[model samples]
Target: MPDWKTTYAHFLDTAKTAYTANEQRGDLLVQGELALAKVTVDVASNDITNIEREEELTLYFQMKQLLNILRAIYNDQFDMQPEKEDALVAAVLYFVSPFDAIPDDAPLGLFDDAQVIDFVHEQLASDIDRFHHEM
Candidate 1:
């Protein structure tokens, strides 16, 4: 198996490149739809009782919110610059990807997802905050 950390790092770098290019060449909306669908299914299939720690719960919620924001962007409910849109799409792709730094079934696996979301959120904080205000 490939090193998960290396894969994660490579994806991040790809996201950065996509963001800087400010072009939407790939099927970002399609990817976003698939990612959101998986997230919705995961949420519906799993019970919240397994979450024991407050921090873990917080991370879960944060990822959910990030996903929602990405969905809105994908659905054209919110408009953004090409760069921002590309960046957000890249982040969502990372979250939906299976080859995470930690497997999703592993203990605290979703933490890696949260970290990726946090990184993206930090990068696009201003735009996201503005969108929230507009909504």
Candidate 2:
């Protein structure tokens, strides 16, 4: 697997490229990136020694929420459209790998949700048709 920095850079670059051609396509990519970032921070920041079992459950729940949001963002692009299953699965994995960017146990885990969100918004600033494309 590629390093986190490389993976995130690729994601941002790909998202920008996609957005330039299709706003909706780009927005979906950005949403996925942001969602991954959110989960990464939530998981990486917890004090494992102090982490409660319930917190683990909550983390899983939050992760699922983020995934659902991503699915919803791409539902239109996916719905009723025939596409390569491998490509679709690969895309999802690409967006998600950022969560595991740094070793979870590393002290001062890398990446932050705020930074990721800012990156997504900045990268997609000029084009927001994707946001409007949804009903």
Candidate 3:
């Protein structure tokens, strides 16, 4: 397997590039958010009951939590520095991009997305804590 940390780092850069594109970034993120929603629904409908791995469950939860946090930021329910905000947006946008470190169609495809979210959460731990506390 490839180095997830490095791969996720590249994802952040890609996401930042897209986010810096203004209106197009908004459209891309919307598409990503919708894709995440669809995946959430699919998991709830079938795979939720079948998921037996602890790691998988943890990743899924992180994906949901970070996405929620990202939504709060976008909705103005939370605040973050522009750089961190851009990173957060980039992490979320990974959901819509098919050409990522790991193909979204492969087994455990979302592993990369979840890891990126976790890394962002760690890097912005205080900001996330503030978001939780302020909300």
Model 1: lDDT to the true structure? 0.62
TM-score list, all predictions:
0.60, 0.33, 0.71
Candidate 3's C-alpha runs over 4 A off are 21-25, 45-57
Query: What tens-digit string does per-residue lDDT give for candidate 3 at 52-115?
Result: 3454556556666666676676566776788887777777666566667788788777767667
- lDDT for model 3: 0.67
> Which candidate leads the pack in lDDT?
3
Local distance difference test scores for all models: 0.62, 0.43, 0.67
- Candidate 2 regions exceeding 4 Å error are 1-5, 10-69, 77-95, 98-101, 110-114, 125-134
Model 2 Cα lDDT, one tens digit per residue, 17-63:
44333355445556565755655565666544445434443544433
**Descending-TM-score candidate ranking:** 3, 1, 2
Model 1 Cα lDDT, one tens digit per residue, 1-135: 345446556775676675443234236545555655655555555454444344455555655666567556656677777666655666666666666777767765666766776776787888878878977
> Can you give the lDDT of residue 133 in candidate 3?
84
Off by over 4 Å in 1: 1-9, 12-52
Clashing pairs in 1: none
- The collision pairs in model 2 are none
